[model samples]
Target: MVALSFISLVGCEASVATHPVSGKVVLADGSPVGGGIIKFRTKSDEGETVKAHGQIQPDGSFQLTTFQDGDGALEGEHEAILFSPATGDGHNAVAAPNFPTKYRKYETSGLKFQVGPGENDFVIQLGTR
Candidate 1:
């Protein structure tokens, strides 16, 4: 049973090494974004793509996880993106608080980060323009 379970887990994801990544999201004025989801995506040297993300705390802090909680992301250049929470349910839903719309898309967001060996820390500050 242990072997079977291990195989199942291995089948789900390739055994790629991930480094610890944690950070805070703040506005230009140094205020926390408050609430949202932040994602980091990158392609491995072997052409495999890995993604990691974490829920933003009320203080804007976050810790990334690729497979397990706080396991982090692969070592490489990562494209970043943020998704604000919805204000209402269903059709009346609106984006959380206020953040630039560009942040919703990785390409236009102009957000990038480098993940290296060991623990990685960052402070993502949102720009006004």
Candidate 2:
């Protein structure tokens, strides 16, 4: 059963355990954002920065995933940024930021979250411009 043993080993090596992280995005008025994207970036103890991203649902819920779907993010502190596609007039070609421009950059957003060894659930509140 050498082949069987090898197959099992391969499968185990391919799967990495991850902590679960989920959150909700809401505005200052406490209304859910219809659509957007959320991202988390953190520097590991090794000094390498890792990023995880998730799509904001219509109900403003999101789950962070790094390597695989729903696999979750690396454990540590993270800076978060939220973004939604800005609408542009037919005459203007450039699309502006839908949310506050300050929120588009992780460093400027003033949004931070710490991920522990276990599951993390967070509620992110956004301020109006």
Candidate 3:
């Protein structure tokens, strides 16, 4: 009974609020990235790091989801990372030829964005270098 009560309490506690984030991933020449994964990572005021990610659409558009589908991410400064590898095996395979590998890691990606209240939209450009 005690364990059940604890679980119920935990479930009842509200989750961190998230704002809607949408964006488009493009290249320096203004061409859409087509297929890839884009992530937005940031640390909350409480020092807990949170992340939101989305699959880059054929049109390079994406909608971030942190906790739930289309729920978005926490508002704050975020580092962006976009990576698309050549065709492989599985549902995670993304066909992004000529995509730079440096953008795969956040530390070397050199991409950043600031999320605000309400709807936060962006257009991220990745370089071939």
Candidate 4:
């Protein structure tokens, strides 16, 4: 399973060779927009599409499985997008919590990422008005 612990600002460390990339999605008020999908895709040396993707947690966190041994898209630049369908008036997480169907996965294409091997920090700012 994937690890989901928060990183400390002090001097803790991770020893795995495989790197991790993390980011945050928030609204104009600086509140997090949680629970959706995040995907990263790139072409391999053989020209085949290599995709590493996962879902954002309820608190707006996400982790995608990158290949070990420094051989994946997490080592370089990538693309990103956020898709949440409800307007959040009365249909959002606090009221409904879970969507009736699926997370809106293709509603926005304005997100992009240039991730590094160990840790790439990103903050996505959005508005509801």
Which candidate number would show the highest lDDT if scored against the true structure?
1
Better structure of 3 and 4 per TM-score: 3
Better of 1 and 2 by TM-score: 1
Q: Write the per-residue lDDT of candidate 3 for residues 53-85, one digit (tens) a residue.
A: 998889989999987889888888999888764
lDDT of 2 by residue, 1-129 (tens): 999999996685356345789988888898877577889988766687778898888888999998778878888888999887554577875433277888889879999999878889999887764
Instruction: Report lDDT (Cα) of residue 55, candidate 2.
Output: 84
Lowest lDDT 10-residue stretch of candidate 1: 91-100
Assess each prediction's global lDDT (C-alpha) against the native.
0.86, 0.81, 0.83, 0.54
lDDT score, candidate 2: 0.81
Clash-forming residue pairs, model 4: none
Model 1 agreement with the true structure over 12-83: per-residue lDDT tens digits: 656678899999998889988777789999997778777899988889899999998999999999999898
Which model is ahead, 1 or 3, in terms of lDDT?
Answer: 1
Error of 2 at 20 (Å): 0.9
TM-score of every prediction relative to native: 0.81, 0.75, 0.80, 0.57
Q: In candidate 4, where is summed lDDT lowest over 10 consecutive residues?
A: 9-18
Displacement of the residue 69 alpha carbon in candidate 2, Å: 0.2
Q: Between 3 and 4, whose lDDT is larger?
A: 3
Candidate 1 regions exceeding 4 Å error are: 1-14, 86-95
Using TM-score, give the best candidate's number.
1
